[model samples]
Target: MRLVRAGRRAFTGNADVLADDDHRAQVTDYFADLVRPFGAGPVTDLSGQSYGEMAKALVAEVVPAAEPVDLLVLAFSIHDVWPGRATATYLSHVCPGTPMSFAVCDQGSASPFTGLRVIGDYGVRRALLVVVEQGALPYESAAATPLAHRGVAMLYEEGAGTRATEVRQYPDVVPEAVPELARRGVAELSTGHPGARVVLSDSLAAVWPDHPDHTRVPAGQPMTGVWWHLAGASEDAVLVGDYDRDLRYLCFAVVAADQSSVD
Candidate 1:
């Protein structure tokens, strides 16, 4: 499948549009009991963007109505404030073709890579991949939240003479072993694609082998960092990667520009 188009949006301030008395009470109670063991206080803030809302906006912008997708995948790491809602199911109804939609999460930043790989495995004629990150947490935690809300939507279709994406992931990759493993992965993915640009998440860049053309994704937006950069890449062939420190998964994808769609 080839990536034909992509679009992204960033949200700031309060996301109070979806907030309601019942939703807030439920979210507050759920988080309160969950964090009580850690001595964390009750959830006082429930202002955050709904993944459904964000993904819907992105779908409308990137995927044309005439070109209905066969599949839609939503990937995220941070929990949405509106947690109880079945976001992926909601998206399927709104998106064209009423595609088979689902969300991938709990694997940290590897979620998107996993989602992309799933789409390829499905052998669909067309697909949509939505990656999103939100910035709010009702209770305090060890994990860092995104600085802002962001979402990216990519349109992929079966076609020739377009940029194709191939995803690879390695699990339980400790920091000490990342350099060697990443170097080998990059080398394999870059083979025959001369001048392929390498884009790495900040954590990956620190341990990655020295490369003259590699670019580092900015910090703060862990889940969306690499994908956000991928949307803006101008290279004909590019390799984007990220290492999830908490989850210990190293994920990468090579986008081969001018390559025929891979079946």
Candidate 2:
């Protein structure tokens, strides 16, 4: 299937608070202007509402009204799913009237891509994919990384926009095999678009080395990679997201349009 339109909403974060002057350079290799933060401050509290509520509302707003959605697939990180927030209830609230609805959870950053495959396997012609993540609590000093509330929506249909050629997940990857695995993954996708770029997820960013057309932007959330590809980056690119080193599962999405039409 292909994406028709996409939108992203990031709450309460700015690009001015990098830990060091060299952080940006180390991130993208392009001398990025600013690093976007997803943690505390005025920007994070834009709607003066709860992250989950605002995120669901944003999904309702960003999804194209003109499109006919047959399926609603909601993706969330472990941080978003909590006690009392039943998935079925939220689905009804955010995507009422859809004939079918489902959720992808526990995959961390790989859930969104899994959602895409779900649509394809179910033969749904039109679908809505939503992913949301919230920042770690202010007092949670044990948090691995500063979290931010973020959400993204994408409208997908059978035959329009940028097509996703291949979406595959690998299991039990060894550290010794990452370089070769990454190289082979990129090489396979590059066959069609020789100039395609690489967008590495947060999991693989530190270990993956830079290459021509390589752009590293840590996915604050699972589906954030799709958001970045749709909102920024080259139209033809490869997205690599690894869920866990121990679980060793890696997900890759190769996006490209008709090569003849691509410039």
Candidate 3:
């Protein structure tokens, strides 16, 4: 499948508009027990962007109404303020195709890569991949959170084009093994696509193989960093990659410009 269209948006302020009093109370109670052990109170402050709302805004700009998708995947790391809602199902109904949709999470930054792999493995005619990150937490831990709220939507479809998107992921990759593994992965991905530009996450850049054509995404957006850059990439062939230190996952996606649209 080839990436046909892509768009992204950054969200600000709280998502209180999306939730009601009952919804907020339920979420607060749900996390009350979990935060007690940390000496933290229940999450009464619901100040984060809703994934459902963020995805809808992106879909509006990226996915065309005439070209409905068969699959919709939402990938996220940070929990949404309105977690009680079934966001994926809601998106499926609002999206043009009424496609089968689901959310992928607890995979750190690799969630989007995993979602893309699923789409390719399923051989769907058209699919929409939504990657989102919010900047709020009910209970605080040592884990890294997004500096800001952001989301990216990419529309992929089967087309008569030589440039197809490919996803690669390696699990249980320790820091010591990153340089070599990353080198091989990049070389393999760049074999056919000449002059492939490499976009690396901040963490990956520290251990990545030195490439003259590489650009490092700003830190703090663990889930959406690489994808945010991918949306604006100008290169015909670009390799977006990141290392999820918490999950020990090394993931990469090779996306090339849609040749069908080229004159």
Candidate 4:
């Protein structure tokens, strides 16, 4: 059965959000510009906080609506990273995918997990994340979906090891491309709505990773997922900010066969 493609944008890892400077506007303004094009459908904007509360509101706003596709993006500050699980839950339950895109703000003084490493055996292959720092954000999804932060994503690893930076902890969810989840646990619907394929990516660059000088990764390895890149299918582009250290966040762009070059 074809399902809708869900994506997300979060400010959980944005160091700028937590900055004491009066640039809080960056957090608010960026969000506004990002979501301006994407009319509300199945997206969660973690601008301020109370994501739990936000979830409840989203349910009320978009429930029993045919599982609409979900797209997330955020330029976070401080309240998001410490409890990375919040964003994880939002992504895991709300939007399904491994190595999900993540844009975190790290100023070398603060960490998303607040002194704890979010290295919970989870791999980026499960979901590709992209972190952009001091760089402007894109304004479109690779799938051509109307979203904030368009264009390509740059990869980097900044502040690999430092006393000021702290590692963080994440949820214990199995983030990989499984054929059918093999009934191992509950099967999450990648798309909140109905669609032939679903692609989730960030429209812009929103994270400043712990290691920003790392070499850029070309693309992400393929995993199990819905056929988001089918031929003759109306490309449903759901765009937002992808905030992970890996540049695979934009992998959602081209996964289908070359239409003109194929049978």
Query: Per-residue lDDT of 3-40 in model 1, one digit per residue for the tens?
Result: 77778899776556545788778888988888888899
- Model 2 clash tally, residue pairs: 3
- TM-score winner: 3
Predict model 4's lDDT versus the native: 0.26
- Candidate 3 weakest lDDT stretch, 10 residues: 254-263
Per-candidate Cα lDDT values, in order, are 0.83, 0.57, 0.83, 0.26
How do these models rank on TM-score, best leading? 3, 1, 2, 4
> Which candidate, 1 or 2, would have the higher TM-score against the true structure?
1
Task: Tell me the tens digit of each residue's lDDT in model 3 across 7-91.
Answer: 8889988775545778777777777776887787764575678888889888888877999999999999877877678999999
- Tens digit of lDDT per residue, candidate 2, span 42-79? 22211111434645666666554555578878777543
For every model shown, the clashing-pair count is 0, 3, 0, 65
Model 4 ranges off by over 4 Å: 1-47, 65-250, 253-263
Residue-level lDDT tens digits of model 4 in 166-202: 1222222122322122111111222332231333211
* Candidate that would win on lDDT: 3
TM-score of each: 0.91, 0.70, 0.92, 0.21
For candidate 1, the 10 contiguous residues with the lowest summed lDDT are 254-263
Runs in model 3 lying further than 4 Å from the true structure: 16-19, 161-163, 209-212, 259-263
Error of 3 at 30 (Å): 2.0
Please list the Cα RMSD from the true structure of every candidate, rounded to 1 decimal place: 3.1, 11.2, 2.3, 18.2
- The residue-level lDDT of candidate 2 at 107 comes to 77
